[model samples]
Target: MKITKLTKGISLKRPLEGGNEEQLQVVRQVLADVRAQGDAAVRAYTEKWDGFTLQELRVSTEEIEQGAKSLDPQLYADLKEAAHNIRFYHEQQKRSGYRVQLANGSWLGQRITPLDAVGLYVPGGTAAYPSSVLMNVIPALVAGVKRIVLTSPAGRDGQLPTGVLAAAHILGITEIYKIGGAQAIAALAYGTESIVPVDKITGPGNIFVALAKREVFGEVAIDMIAGPSEIAILADDTAFADEVAADLLSQAEHDALACAILVTTSERLAEEVAQEVEKQVAALPREKVARASIAHFGAIYIADTMADAVEAINSLAPEHLEIMTEQAEQVAEQIRHAGAIFVGRYSSEPVGDYFAGTNHVLPTNSTARFASGLNVDDFVKKTSMVYYSEQTWANHAPKIARLARMEGLEGHARAVESRGWRKGE
Candidate 1:
């Protein structure tokens, strides 16, 4: 890892991947075919990419039960407990409609309604992510979404991962499909012979899945165009170097594009962490991936002061931030931009990734400056409600009309005036 002095306007912003032309063309073609052929297109694509022929698009209830039963006893118990914790945390985010009446007998408010249906895409290429199932599904359930569908690629043996299926079963999700890639996204956005279309889609996948979501966004709402995973640690002299290196490598092992950064006030701590990272990464099973990430994207910055370090971190606006300074909590409170902040040595990044109640799906590629992690709000829609009494309209008609006319919208002005209120009436 390279060490540099912290400077103004420095950033670790990686460019968001928008698939290449060939990939985009392939995604567009798949979406079009899925829309035209429905289940046939999905089956064809699944067989081609996943190497499994699908006799049925939907997973049977019996299969779900069997898969859940097949999980190891301890793992099943852990999933149930994690599901409970996630549900408890998101339940606090549920919202209700509210209205406030004005003195003029008019009312204005907002109504919160859960989406009718939602699709969750769990990636199944290199690894199975049962934790993602717990993170994405629990919030939608808390938001009161009625119909939730899960889709993932099947293995060569024609079965989804037992852990993924077990996680879904624990959450009471019955509608699942053995489909993946751009075709699955298409089927979710547009109804097929067996699968019903959803109002919104969430979860992460490869570049093709991301491109498919982008193409179908107007047809159905999507969570975000997620980039590679990233973590930034802000540590001081009080922080332990070995522990810091472990936390940084946790994300580096995720992808070759994954970024790991450390900003510290102590140069000694920076050097120690770099050495520890090099020594520890050699032992990981995913050593090749982690080594590539650390070699290309990993770095340590030496800040003259703690304030400068925090400022630099704010500019980076990392997806996951760990503050391991003397006053970790105080330093975290000063942070203005981060998808999620883990304070102190005990709150490691993986805690939030797996067992912690906080949602792990977060903004990436510096988008935390404006975006947020997935939450209950993502599964619900807010509709503004306005009720104007005749007297209230009579009082404000002229002003409303005048404002409309100022924008050079004659039709809008006429529509407001057409409410039948005249001057001096």
Candidate 2:
């Protein structure tokens, strides 16, 4: 990792590539082919990308039961506990419709309802993310989404990892499919013979899946276009260097492009953390990946003051921010932009990622400046509703017609005039 002195009014560019047009065009062609040929197109692409020829696209209940039975008893118990915490947290975010009546008997409000069905695209094969199954599915379930379907690339064994299947089974989601990549997204957006189209798609995937989601957004709703995982730790002399190094490597090992940054007011602590990162990274199993990520995107920034550190952090708008200062909570309260904030040394980012009930599906690539992490609200839609009684219509009709006329929309004026109501006084 490179060490640098903080400069005012400077912006840093991300080293990772955003989806290029070539990738977009490939996703476009795949989506077009799937929309045209349905199941046949999906099958061909699945073979091309996943390298698994499928006689059946969907996983059966027997397979799910087998997966459940294959899991270690302790791990299975932990999964249930994680799911419980995740569901409990998201249930608090669930919303109900509300209406407000006016003095003239006009009612206006919003109706909140879950999508009929949703598709969860879990990264599979080498990426074993059973935690993601719990993270994505639990929120949809909490929001009352009835039909939750999951798609993942199968390994050479022609089945999803037993743990992934077990996680789905625990959530009562049986509609698992052995398809992945851009094609799975295409199939989810525009239905095939075997898979019914879903109203929304969620979860994380590779660049192909991200581009595919971008292509099919209008056809069906989708969660944010996820990027590489990242973390930023704001620390002082009070923070333990070893713990900070471990947390940084935890995100760095996620991918070759994942970013890990440390911003601190203590130059002494910055040097210590950098040395600790070097020592700890040497022992990691994914050393190559962590090294690549740290070399390319990681940095240690020395800020002149704590306020400067906070300002720099907000400018970066990192996916995860951990404040390990003496006054961690106070520093956290001052932060205006971050996907998720982890306060103090004890509150590590992985706790939110796996077991601490918060969703790990966060906005990346500085999207935390405006967007948010996934929650129960992502699974539902809000529709604005209005109703007017006869007296209310009579009171407002002429005003509506006059405004429509002012906008030179005669059709709109005529529609209001034809409601058989007296003109407003």
Candidate 3:
């Protein structure tokens, strides 16, 4: 990992910023082909990418049930338990519509409702994330989404992951398909013969998936164009080196492009954390990916003061941040950015990733400034609804008419004037 004294007013460009773009154009082409040919195009792309020649795009009910039965009983139990907890958490976020009456008898408020059908694209093949099934489905289920479909690439065995199927059983998710990449996204956006079009799509995937989501924004609502996982730690002299190293490695293990950085005022702590990372990383099973991530993207920036450290962290706006300073709580208050904040050594970034009752899907690539981590709010929609009585119409009709005429909108003025009320003195 690179070690340098943290500099104020200096910005470090992310290495992923200069990544390959030829692949992006290919993904766009795949999306366009799928959009034009529908399922036929998707089937060809699936064979090209996942090496699967599917007889059917949609998975069978028996296959899902058999998948559940194939998994370890204990893991199946755990998946159900996790689903319960996630559903309970999201249920609390379910919003209801309310009517607010004005003094003139006008009523207006927001009506919160769920999307009719949604698709969750889980990363498949090399990486099968059943945890993601729980994370994405629970919120939609709680939001009253009736039909939640799932799509993932089929394995070489010509079947989906058992764990993924078990998660579906726990959540009662019926609709699923053996499809992936940009083509799958296009099929979901513009429905095929077998696959139904969904109101929205959520979950994470590779660069191709992100670009496809960006392209299909108007056709179907997407969650976010998620980037690689990243973690940034701001620690002072009081921080524990071991804990800091573990937190950094947690993110680094996600992929070779994943970034983990440390910004601190204490030179001694920075050196200690670097050494600890080296020792700890060797023990991880994904040591190769972690080491590559640390070597290429990881860094320790030693700031002269705490304020400088805080400023640098804010500018970076990492997906996950940990403050292990003496005033970790105080530092948290100064922080105006970051997808999620972990205070003190015990509240490490990984805690929020699993079993911490917080959604781990976070914004990356300096997007924390405007975007937010995945939450129950992502699954629901709010529509502003209004009702007006005759007295209320009388109360505000003239003002509405004047404003409409001032704007040269006779139709708008007549709509108000057609209320059949006399103009008062």
Which one is best on lDDT? 1
For candidate 1, lDDT tens digit of each residue in 151-270?
Answer: 988888888889999999999999999999999999999989999899999999999999999999999999999988999999999999999999999999999989999999999999
Total clashing residue pairs per candidate? 0, 0, 0
Query: What digit string (tens of lDDT, one per residue) describes model 3 on residues 242-285?
Result: 98899899999998889999998988888999999999999999
Candidate 1: residue 299 Cα off by (Å): 0.8
Encode model 2's per-residue lDDT on 306-408: one tens digit a residue.
9998999999998999999998999999999899999987899999998989999998889899999999899889999989887888788899999999999
Q: Model 2: what TM-score?
A: 0.97
Q: Which scores higher on lDDT, 1 or 3? A: 1
True-vs-predicted CA distance for residue 342, candidate 3, Å: 2.2
Clashing residue pairs in candidate 2 are: none
- Give lDDT for model 3: 0.85
Clashing pairs in 3: none
Worst 10 residues of 2 by lDDT: 9-18
lDDT of 3 at 184: 85
